[model samples]
Target: GCLPISIIGLLVETTHLSLVTPVGWWLLVYSTVVQFCIAYVSWFAALARLPASVAAIGTMAVPVIGVVASAIALGEPLGAGQIAALVFTLAAVVLATR
Candidate 1:
């Protein structure tokens, strides 16, 4: 029922995740949930400490972090083009937050 909708909710619901077993996948999701919980609290704290506009600017790094993490953790390919884009994006994000 909810599976299809949840699948749509995922950013990279692709062939890669299919290689892992159900239990292994659940463990990964549990770990991610824990990390997200920690990050959520920290981000909330950061929001309180900084101006909303500053927080908005800093939030742009989330995609860069996601790409790097996914490439490292899942062995996803981060081609030269993608790497260049990530670098530029992050550089822009740094400039934006400054």
Candidate 2:
């Protein structure tokens, strides 16, 4: 799903490759291997083992986690709308599991 967009982004940003420091390159490689490769494989393996409903609820929780993580790690603001959305998402996940 993301391959095409990633390819395009890589092509577009190729000229700026010189801007990346050695540490930045290492971080990118680490993120690619850990986030894209290991995380996806682990997620799929767990999904295969879990019941459908549980897996679905777990999938739904991903965005909620992302929102909270961003708020804490990136100093991103979580206003009323985001809080409400998170509440609604949790409610839906609860309802779905039952």
Top candidate when judged by lDDT against the true structure: 2
Candidate 2 lDDT tens digits, 42-95:
778878899777777768899999999999999999999999999999998898
Clashing pairs in 2: none
* Candidate 1 residue spans exceeding 4 A from truth: 1-37
Please give, for residues 47-76, the per-residue lDDT of candidate 1 as tens digits.
Answer: 999988788775798888889999999999
Candidate 2 structure lDDT = 0.89
Assess candidate 2 and give its TM-score to the true structure.
0.82
Q: Would you list the C-alpha lDDT of every candidate in the order shown?
A: 0.85, 0.89
Task: Provide backbone clash counts, one per model.
Answer: 0, 0
Q: Model 2 off-target regions past 4 Å?
A: 10-14
CA shift of 18, model 1, Å: 18
Location of the lowest summed lDDT over 10 successive residues in candidate 1: 9-18
Q: What lDDT does candidate 1 reach at residue 82?
A: 95
